[model samples]
Target: MASNFSRQEPWNLSQENLQEWFQDNVEEGSRSFAVESNKSMDDLVRFLHNMPDMKTKGPKAKPVKVKEVRKGGSIEKGTFYKDGSDLDCVVVLNGIPKLKANTKTGKYRRGHLKPLVEKVVTALQQASFTARCEKVSNLQLKVYAKQETGGILEIDILFTGNNLDYNYIDDEVTMQRILSTPYNTMLNMPPKSQRFIYQPCLTPLQTEFVKSQPGNVKSLIRLVKYWKAEYLHQRQTEKLINSYTLELITIYVYEEEMGSPDRFDLGEGFKRVLSLLAYKLGGFQHYWDNFYSDETAQRGMKLKDMMKRPILLDPADPSDNVLQRWKKGLGTISEIARETLQTPLLRSIHVN
Candidate 1:
C-alpha cells in the first residue's frame, strides 16, 4: 500500500483524515493480503504434515521422527506485509535430543544440526519442492521452499529433546532460569533453545501476544511494518529491524499513548512510533510480564546487566534481546524515522 505522505507535498491533514487514509489504504491492504496468504499457508502446512518420516545418514543414521509442525511469525500473528512475505514453519522433531552446550567452553558446537538440515532439504526436494538451505547465522539454519505461485516458505526445523514441553511458560523454575541467564550465553545458547532449538514451543505464546491485541492495534502494527519496509528498501547492507521488534514497539507506543482504549487515532500512534524511533530509540527498553512476572524481570535485568540501552526482550523468551544485533544500524534507522516523521502527512499531526 502507498503512503499518503510525500516529500514535496505539504498536506495539512487532521488526525481523523490520517486515520481514514490509514483505514482505506494500510488496513484494507493487510486484510486482502492476509486472505490470500492464509490460503497458501494452509496448503503448505497440510503438505508438510503428510510427508513421510525423513532419515539421515552417518554412523548413527536413523529415521528423523516428526513430532509436530508449527506456524509462526507474521503470517501466523496476522501482521504480514504484502511485499517479501514468507511463513516461519518450525518443524519439531521427536527422538532427537537437544544439543547441550559444552561445559568447558559454555558454548554450543556450531553447525551441530547440519546433518538434520541436509536430511530435511533432501526430503523436500524428493517431494518435488525446490528447496535450498542456508545457515543464516551461528544460531539460525533455515530452509526456503520455492512455491509454484512464486512465493517462498521459510522453514526452521528444530531438533529438541522431550524435556522442553509446550507448557514451559507455566513452569516457574524454567522461567527464572531463562530470565536470569546473561545475554551473551543466552544469545549463544538460548534457554531451552528457544531462539534456535526449541523456538517452535515458544511460537504459540509469541503468536498469542500479538494476536490478542485489538483490531486497530494490529492495524497500527501493519502500518509501522509497511513504513519499515519502505524505509529499508534497497538498503540490504544495513541491519534491518525484525518484524517482531517493530510489532512490540508499535504496541508499546499505543499502550503508552492511548492506554486501554478500544479505539484511538491510528495516525497519532504512527507518528509517536516514528517520534520514539527518531528520538528515543537509543535508550529503548521494553518488556512484558504476560508470561513472566515483573519481579523476575527486574531480578533478571540486574543479574544479566540487561538494563543496557535498546533492550527489546522477547515476551515469550526473556533471554532474547531482539535488538542486540541491530546496534550498528540504529543511527541509520533513527535518521530514516526522523525523515519519515517530517514527511508532509505526518508532520502536520500534533503528537501530545
Candidate 2:
C-alpha cells in the first residue's frame, strides 16, 4: 500500500487515477501460459548477458513466462509471434534506477549499463544486429529490434525492481554497523558493498491485474512504465503523454464492465486481461475468489468507448488542446479506493 499516485489531470502517475483505471479497464478473467514460437526473445536473452551488470558479474535473473493476448472471446495461447514476424528478446532487471543515462552514480548504471542501448546500436551497425531503443521506464526499458530485410523483432527489457540498497545496520555483538542481508538475488554481496533496490508488491487482485493482458495489462503496463518515466526523475510518472491515454482507457473499462472478482483471473494474465479487462471494467469483483465464468461479466463496470472522437488544436478553445481533448473522453471519472458490502476497503498494489 506504499503508493505514490496523484489525481490531478494531464494524468501523471497518481494512485488515485491508477485505482480508477484498473477498475474501468480490467476484465474479470484468469490467464496462464502456453508457448509456441518467438524471434526477438532470443536476441533479448543475448542482450541481457551483454548488459554491463552481467558482463561484470552483477545479478542476472531468468525470464519467466506470462500470458498472451486475446482473440474472439477466447485466450490466445501461443508464442509471442508466428511466421516471419519480427521478434525481440529481453532481460527484465531489478535493483536499477530510472535516472537518466548521464546520472554518473547509480548501481545499475555506473557508466557501464548506462551506455548499453547506444553501444548495442553501435555493435549492431558493425555486426548486423538490428535493434532500436523504444521506450524507457522507471524500472523497465522497452527496446525494439527487427530484421532489416522483412521481419519483426522487438524485445522489451522490463526492468522490474526490488529495493537494492547498501544500508548498514549495527551488529550488537560486533558493536559496529553491518550491511543488511537482502533476499531474492542470484549474486553474492560483501558487507561493505551490499546492493540496494526497490521492489513492488501487488495484491492477489493486483497480480491478477498485471497478467490481465489486454485488460488492465495494457493500462497497467502504461502505469508501470509511465510512472517510472515521469516520477522516478525530478518530475512524476503521470506526466507522460501516454500516461493520460492510459488513464483514460482505464476509466473507460471500470465505467463500462465491472466483472466479478474471480473472473478477473480468467484466461491467463495476458489473454484474459486483453480479452476481458482492458477497457472492460464492467465486471470486477470487489471481493476475492479464483476461476471465472461468463456470468461474471454480466454485472460489470460502467465502460464506454471514449477515445474515438474529433478534435482541433486551438488554444482559445481550450477543449481544442490535447489535454482538453482527453478531458472530453467519456467516463473520465477518477477514484482512489472503493467500498463494498464486505466493507472490503482497497489499497494501492505495487510489485516488481
Candidate 3:
C-alpha cells in the first residue's frame, strides 16, 4: 500500500496555486536587486583590490591584497524577501597588523581591527562612491548602491582579518583548532560594555549550508521570512528577531517532519514550519554538529541557559544562540499561526 503522504498533491493557500504564486511573485522579488547589486559589487571589489597603501615604504610598496569576498545574509542565502533593500558582504583584509597582547586579560586587544575597517570606508569614499562608516558595536562600512528607481540599496561591508591557518581540511580536530585560532578571531563587544574581546570568526560555512539546500527548501525559508515580516508589522513591536533564526527553524522543520529535501513540497514545508511555531515552539531545541566538533557541540549545549525558548545553535558559530532573545515575538508568531490555521480553508492544508 502506498503511504498517504507520498500520494498527496501540492496544496496552495491562495486562490492561485502555490507554484504559480511563487513563480509570479516570490521568486521574482530578488531579480532586480540581484542584477543591480552585482554590478556595484564588482566595481567596489575592483576598487578595493587596486587601492594602494600609502603607509607602505618607498621601494617595496605594493597594493593591498584582499584575500576573499564572502557573501552573507538573506541575499546570499537566496531567501531575501520581496522589496529587500540590503546586501551583506564580508571582505578579508590580508596582512593586517596583529594586536598587542593585553597583560591584564592574557589575550590580544582588538582595538586595531576597528581602524582597519575604517580604512575600508575611507577608500570607498575616496573612490567617489557614496560610502560612509556606520557607528555601531561592530565595524560595518555602509555603501549606498546606485539605484535609478525603488529604495536605495545598502551594502554592508563587514571586515574580517585573513586567517591563513584555515586551510581546506576534512579532519574535525584540525578544523576545530583552526576555528579557535587567534587568526580566525573578530572583534565583538557586548552592548554598553567597556570590555572588548574577540569572537570566533564567521566563515562561509553558513552561506554554503543554505546554498547547498534544494531550491524548494530555499523557498520554504522565504515563506517563513515573509510571514515573520507580516507578523511583526501587524504587532508593531519594537523588538526585532534575527532572520537567520527563522531560517534555521524552517530547516529543522523540513528535516524532521518532511524528511529529505529531494521530495520536499513548498506547501507541506510551510505547514510543518508554521505548525512548529504554532504548537511546539516553547523550549524547542534542535541542532547538528555537521560543521563543528563534538566538543563544540557539548560546549554549545551550555549556551542554552541564556535562551528563553526555541533554542537553535548556529551551525557555524556554536557560541551564538540564534534564537536567544526572541521570546515575546515568538509567542506572537505562535498565536498568529494558531489563528491562521483555524481558518476553515487553511485547516486541511495545515493539519496532519
Residues 65-172, candidate 2, lDDT per residue (tens digit)?
211111100112111112111122223334343332123334554433444444444444343444455445433344444553454444334333322332212232
Candidate 2 residues lying further than 4 Å off, grouped into runs, are 1-37, 46-108, 115-121, 124-142, 147-154, 158-208, 212-352
Which portions of model 3 show Cα errors greater than 4 Å? 1-16, 54-66, 97-110, 126-133, 167-200, 237-239, 304-309, 342-345
> Each candidate's TM vs. the true structure?
0.79, 0.30, 0.76
State, as a TM-score between 0 and 1, how close model 1 is to the true structure: 0.79
Error of 2 at 289 (Å): 14
- Where does candidate 2 have its weakest 10-residue lDDT segment? 336-345
Question: What lDDT would candidate 3 get against the real structure?
Answer: 0.59
- Winning candidate number (TM-score): 1
Q: Across residues 1-352, which tens digit of lDDT does each residue of candidate 1 receive?
A: 1244453222345455776766676677767767766665565567667767765455665666667767777878877777534457666666554543422222322223455565555555555444666665433456665665676666554443332454435565565455443323344542344344444456767887888788788877887877776655534445477788888888888787568577777777888888888899887777888766676555445434334678877787665677776777778888778767766678677766
Where does candidate 3 have its weakest 10-residue lDDT segment? 1-10
Instruction: Flag regions of model 1 displaced more than 4 Å.
Output: 1-5, 8-16, 55-63, 84-86, 98-112, 126-163, 167-195, 234-237, 302-307
lDDT of each: 0.63, 0.29, 0.59
